[model samples]
Target: MRWNAEFMSPSGRVPFIKCGAFVVSELEPIVQFAANKGVTLCSRLSTEEKAEMRAYMSLITNVLVNAELYISWLDEETFNAVTKVRNSSVYPWPLGWLQTRAKRNAVAKRLKALNWHDKTLDQVLADVEQCCNSLSQRLGDRDYFFGTPTELDALVFGHVFTIITTRLPCRKLAETVKQNKSLVALAQRVDEQYFKRP
Candidate 1:
């Protein structure tokens, strides 16, 4: 909810990181920046597997991210209940209301540009299902997507875990993720290893 930080970001978004004087925003650029600094998680993966990883990552971004925007901003129930409150929490008075409205409008326009604005809730859910299906199939019985934790795994965990855990008015999104056992297991593994302490 760092509203001012988001505005300060070069990309005008959250999830930006600063390493000393270098600042990187967005996931792919962050990953690339790390790689340039001799830090990489996919070093052991073969070239073809890396390509597949990128494909799956693209799928998650195109499908799951759009669905999230749809649910968070365009879904009236969720906007009125959750997003508005959380996004506007940093401000007071009419400023909070105005900022939230402007943010929602921007999201609506972006969704429309991406052709995701018109999808029904069910359609958006279906897109999420398909994305999860691809991820599950790729993961198979592996602990991660490529026998090791890659960026794809991190990306998947970020989105899937949030969907399942966040308190949404519509439970269908979480339910869809839970339906995929493999994906659920992946999320559980990531959560336990990275998020939970012994």
Candidate 2:
């Protein structure tokens, strides 16, 4: 289940290339959830929008699966080290006996520039909400999109999970998702089934 990290870095690939393996590993439970919801892959919408959503959703799901596989391969020490580095501004490891502060600063500046987005956090959240709401409206009271749980459901579910779990600035959207009973339930189910194991 090896993945190309460079390919996974892009926003478009993040959901699918990184997340697809996770979905596959937890396919049984996910399928059960979909069955309960009566979601079908073949949606009722016309050609264009349906196709577009399906493509986006598929990419997201693939990424989630890949991420799951990556995490599973990490040992406890590695996991803790990664967690610490993510939580703290300071580097978790020694940079070498004579590393200079200026060098570190230069690296940080480069990384920040690489991650700079044109949109603000609020703007990003708004965009996510718009997509969710549009899909939800299309979904109506049905448990899932289309007739059964398709790639879209898994991708949407994984995105909600990442939103809640990560320290990204757009956490407001994640909090909002928590307020959605259906979405939260889906996230919980997916996490419990796929991510609960050591």
Best candidate (score: lDDT):
1
Residue 129 error, candidate 1, Å: 0.7
- Clash totals for all models, in order? 0, 27
For 1-198, candidate 2 gives per-residue lDDT tens digits of: 323332344331332322343432243345445555686454456688577665666544443332322232222343344433442333334542123344334434543454422334444445555555665666566666664655666667766777677653323555655666666566676677667988
Pairs with steric clashes in candidate 1: none
Off by over 4 Å in 1: 1-3
Candidate 1 lDDT tens digits, 1-198: 455999878999878999999889999999999999899999998999989889998998899999989999999999889999988889988899999999899999999999999999999988889888878987889888888888999999999889889989978889998999999888989999999978
Residue 153 CA displacement from its true place in model 1, Å: 0.6
lDDT of 2: 0.49
TM of each candidate vs. truth: 0.96, 0.45
Candidate 1 displacement at residue 17 in angstroms: 0.9
Stretches of candidate 2 off by over 4 Å are 1-84, 87-116, 166-170, 189-198
Give the RMSD in angstroms, all C-alphas superposed, for model 1.
1.2
